[model samples]
Target: MSVHETIEQALVAPSYLAGGGDPGWVTVPLHRACDWSYGHDPLMPRVILTSPDQQATLRIDPDPDEPWWTVRHARCGDRPAWSATFDARTPVEIIAALTDALTAPTPPAPGLEPYDLLRQAGWHTVGEGLISPGRIAAIEHYGGEDGPWFADARLDQDEGGLIWRAYLSNTTPPHLIAAFAQALADPTPVRRPVGRVPAPAREHTLTRTVHLPVGDVAFALEQRVAALSARRKDATSNTHPPRSPRVPPPRRTR
Candidate 1:
């Protein structure tokens, strides 16, 4: 149906494959979402999703031999869910489904400024068209009018399948990063046979790690300014220009 639908279907797969009957998983929203570059390959398709409750992450892989794409689920929260596989012929449906699902009934936080949303959602803002290779990514604090991060994706296709490396930076709780991870690990239909495997055009393995602080830089600046002001006050007497008062003529009372 949709990418979101596929994920839900994949997640809610009959559960019979594992064992006897169990309560099937009902549909749910995808609170967060992201996408990355994926060229045709038989192995891993670069697409993934994380649950709205911050509970689980899902990955879809491309499988040539199987009827359905393989799906992996990692439950971050207390609930234990096993990884399974499913099919997705068209990916647009799945992506749209996720967008719709994430837009569901959850109440927006009270007085959530854009910054708050970005922080809680773990996202970053990046300048438009600034993505490139081998540059320390440029990003602002999460939730400002300007974004905190952007990604330049590198894709490689070999005899095996597609492999993707995305240089990501963002102040928004790194939600896009999480989405990338989820998408990479999630299964997808093998659009092309594992072409001739080449030396990975970019040298890196399965994962790339980035360490950056996330949140409001402006807020930090404000705090710093306040601190400096207090220190300045502490260092000096209140010796600015003294106030001058004008005396009015005595009232000619009766």
Candidate 2:
């Protein structure tokens, strides 16, 4: 059966035991435990479904000049195991191939992994079969290798919730790790959105549930830290308030 079938089955099937409540939405959480790999680039890779529709591919090309980027290919209708390549710049034509493969009226395999599930729910990427375990495990969405790296994307039903692990690799500063860990632990956005929303307020909650894998979380942390550092040069040029002046102490007794 395809992933759609599995979802249908799960919907009617009795809820199974899991960490979070309501098996109806538990798939998002359990999927987080599954592992996915990434390239050394500071950003999350772009996922492309291959033509001929064999496996889902996560590709990261940090250097456009380089022949190849990192590729992690996972077969559909199979368990989470995947094959990875450090350098392989794929041709642009492959995007069309992937789109055709996924947009097909019927998928060769019915049951899809988490990556496919999110796509079926209306999420779109550059390619088909391009679902990544990280994408599905966590509801991460971005364009190209360049990113707005999200640490955790999650969904909740009646207070029950699921969390993703969206971490990146090769980080130096420690606070950045804390920031990601903080985001993961506290998905709340006590802070306000920096920009304006073109649309009127909808019933949607400010917070969302993204089921990112733990491996992805580490990767996201790295990306966030690096991005922060890149801004430091510009930030240092700005001015700051000096330390508060201290008042003089009263005279001591003789």
Flag regions of model 2 displaced more than 4 Å.
1-153, 156-164, 167-173, 182-254
Query: What global local distance difference test value does model 2 have?
Result: 0.29
Q: Write the per-residue lDDT of candidate 2 for residues 109-136, one digit (tens) a residue.
A: 4344434444554444534223222232
TM-score of 2: 0.17
Best by TM-score: 1
What is the lDDT of every predicted structure here?
A: 0.30, 0.29
Q: Residue 147 in model 1: shift from native, Å?
A: 44
TM-score for predicted model 1 compared with the true structure: 0.20
- The digit string of per-residue lDDT tens for model 1 on 1-254 reads 32222111112111111111111011112211122222345455444555534433444444545423222334445633333333333222233223322222332233444233334433343453332122322222334333432221233223233222222223222332333333322333211112211233213222222222222321333443354445445434354555678888999978
lDDT of 2 at 17: 10
TM-scores for candidates 1 onward, in order: 0.20, 0.17
